[model samples]
Target: MARGKTQMRRIENATSRQVTFFKRRNGLLKKAFELSVLCDAEVAVLIFSTRGKLYEFSSKSIKETIERYKRHKKDIQAKNPPVEQNKQHLQQEMASLMENIEHLESSKRKLSGEDLGSCTTEELLELEQQLERSISSIRTRKIQVFRQHVEQLKEKGTALAVENAMLRNKLSLQQERGSNKEKATVPSADISEVSDVETDLFIGPPETSRKRAL
Candidate 1:
């Protein structure tokens, strides 16, 4: 009959677990020894029992193996240089960010008009000068914007004046072309009435225009 497969699980009983650990440790040490002798390969194994007992097997000095492992790790790290550079860059960025945050906090306190009680007279004067310069800059910008707006209004006014002159010239040309015919077809009083209506429609009184502008 074939033997049943052993279930892979923790042995529940303390005595059973201890026995298993002892057997497995011995088996592992024997395997390491055989592997080193038969294959002529370096081998190292380490095990720690639940009771804090240590078991180890090494084809050569364990210290030599550990040092080799450490050197191998360093070689791998040296081969990948970007990892260390990126780590240092990230550290520098974090430090810079922290410094920027502190500066911003200090500026915020100054802007809020706080933490000035301990300031020296020279520092206070410097802060006052900075504020004055800022206000002057703001006022200069405001004046520039106002001038731009006025210039835009003047451009629009010039365009309107040119359009009005063109319209007047067109009206005069039409009037000159039809003057004789209009006189023959209409009475003098009716001509005057039409002229008054045209004037009122095309050209409002100057005082009214001025009031509206204001």
Candidate 2:
């Protein structure tokens, strides 16, 4: 005859519940032993009855199995750590960034002449003096740079003037040499004319010479 499936629930009778506990405990231990031996695996199982009786099974020493479990849990936690600590660290970094951003914004507002209502009279005076000092420094540096630029220009002008003088002197010397050459040519032509005239006078008029002899 086919029997119906037994309903899985707490047994109401004390004796029946105790009998079920014993049977289930023995079956569980037998299954664990078979799994370890067949698969060559390390196995551990623990059971506690309602009356606080402890039952356990282990392929090796229960203490060794417990230690191994603890080590495996630690390794898993190290590899995939809890999110709460990372969340806290990120929150702290976000708060610090927000504070820095706010500080920078406040400084920017002050520099732009906004948010002045919060400043005391002394702080205003100090800010004014600091601005004045910055302006003075900037103006002084500008003037120094201008002076340096002007000095450079003056040096350049002086060098150009000296170069111009040298060019003019060289041109004047060339012109003088050219003029001297022209004058030397003219003198040579005059000397040739004078020589011709003297020769004619010395050997001229044979009739005049015969008259003087007679």
Candidate 3:
């Protein structure tokens, strides 16, 4: 036969309640003593009777044990702060970050020439000076970039000039060689390609030509 399971609830009869409390309280005290003695553990227990009686047990002096417990609890709490404290800290940090963001946004708006209606004369002057400084820096950078470009162009121009000179020298040499070949082949036909005529015909300015024509 299965034994009936005892329900774990208050015994309604006053005499039964007192008896149960006395029995359980002594059992708990005995367990605490055994745990401390057998396991080398610091144990404490507290029980209250219905008639306002206190039953307490501790491996050492109860005051000292409680103080030690308080110290250990403090150390544990210090190592791992409560969730509420961490939450509050995060909230404060977020608030500070939001404030900084707002300040930066306001500054950006001011710099962009927006939200100027609330600015004082002194603030506006400061902004103007800041803008002037910024513009000066931009102009300096532009000049620097322009000078670099100019230097690059000058280098390219020099390179082109040197190339042109080399080409001219080569062309001159080729022309001399061609002329010598032509002279050896046909001395009578010593014809050469020239850009200008070397005659005594002085072709002056257009006005002089017109005068001479007149």
- Where does candidate 1 have its weakest 10-residue lDDT segment? 194-203
Q: What ranking of all candidate models by TM-score puts the best one first?
A: 3, 1, 2
Scored by Cα lDDT, where does model 3 land? Answer: 0.90
Candidates 1 and 3 compared by TM-score, better number: 3
RMSD (CA, angstroms), candidate 2: 10.5
When summed lDDT is taken over every stretch of 10 residues in candidate 2, the lowest stretch is 195-204
Tens-place lDDT per residue, model 1, 1-214, is 9999879998899998888888888988999999999999989998887778888889998999999999998998788767779899999999999999998898678766898888789878888888899999999999999999999999999999999999999999999879978777778767677673322332588888657556
lDDT of 2 by residue, 1-214 (tens): 9998878988899999999899989999999999999999999999999999999999999999999989999998899777997799889999999999998898778767899899999878887887899899999999999999999999999999999999999999999999999988998888887773323343558888667556
lDDT of 3 by residue, 120-183 (tens): 9999999999999999999999999999999999999999999999999999999999999977
List runs of model 3 lying over 4 Å from the truth. 1-19, 147-214
For model 1 the TM-score comes to 0.53
Point out the higher-scoring one by TM-score: 2 or 3.
3
Off by over 4 Å in 1: 1-23, 26-42, 48-61, 72-115, 180-214
